[model samples]
Target: MASEILAQLQAQKLLIVNPRRKNGLIIYKKYYAEFAGPGAIVGGQFDCDAIAVLPVGKISLIVPQTPEERRQAYKMRRQWVKLTKQITDNPIPAERAQVILNQFEHWFDAQTVENLPDEAFALLVGVLPQTITKVRNNGLF
Candidate 1:
């Protein structure tokens, strides 16, 4: 029975959420044990800058599988791509941009625009696409 459970776990594929950018949700196809370590934050750390890992079941709960959700997801992914381009255009190094992306991911999960730290909010607002401004300003994201 234990081995059967372990086998099931090994076959599981988790969804990783990088809330700040496009292509934020990725499938984690590797063994779950690979992420069992000291630094493991939500299933185990991957090469992604800042990602939240969860089972597909859990992700489905948080992100409904609906037309509206699909629209929002696609929009966020496009914004993420734009954000990456902006980062490339600026003097900020790729390493630093990754850090910034991670910060945004945390902010997305933890705080609303209204409650977010001013500096962080300002930095994002300055670089983010205009399409995102409405949601950001309304404190909805």
Candidate 2:
């Protein structure tokens, strides 16, 4: 689902930042081990699933200074609904829209500091040419 969204975003020329890596064992030990047990260890990584489509003649920049600065940068980019709406409004079919929405929802669901599954991170990096092909065939976008 996320791969589908990424493909659509890229097609619309949106900029996507790489997601953050997760230290799976470290995170599990530090957080969930108390309830799930050591045997329930899981791991994953994440990228900022946020997409930013710069306004015409405008450029988007990412400057990673301190960790706090990086967080702020991501937050600002994530909250830019203008960019998202532009991409979403690109004449895509309803099915395509739903796929993108699902992916975005999944990313939103993983916004917490812990307990995010590895699959979420995997989705962060996955690509979906199939979605693009479908859109192209349907002449939706």
Best by lDDT: 1
lDDT of each: 0.33, 0.31
Q: Candidate 2 lDDT, tens digit per residue, 32-115?
A: 111111111111122222242111111122224365655554464444333344444545444443454344444443243223
Model 1 lDDT per residue over 1-141, tens place = 323323333444222243433212222233211111111112122323222222211122123346565455445445554654454465533333344445455534433323433333223323333323434444333
Cα TM-score of candidate 1? 0.29
Q: Please report the TM-score between candidate 2 and the true structure.
A: 0.24
Error of 2 at 126 (Å): 11
Residue pairs in candidate 1 whose N, alpha carbon or C atoms collide under 3 angstroms: 22-77
Listed per candidate, the RMSD to the true structure in angstroms reads 13.2, 16.8
Task: Give the range where candidate 2 is weakest over 10 consecutive residues by summed lDDT.
Answer: 30-39
Candidate 2 Cα deviation (angstroms), residue 90: 14
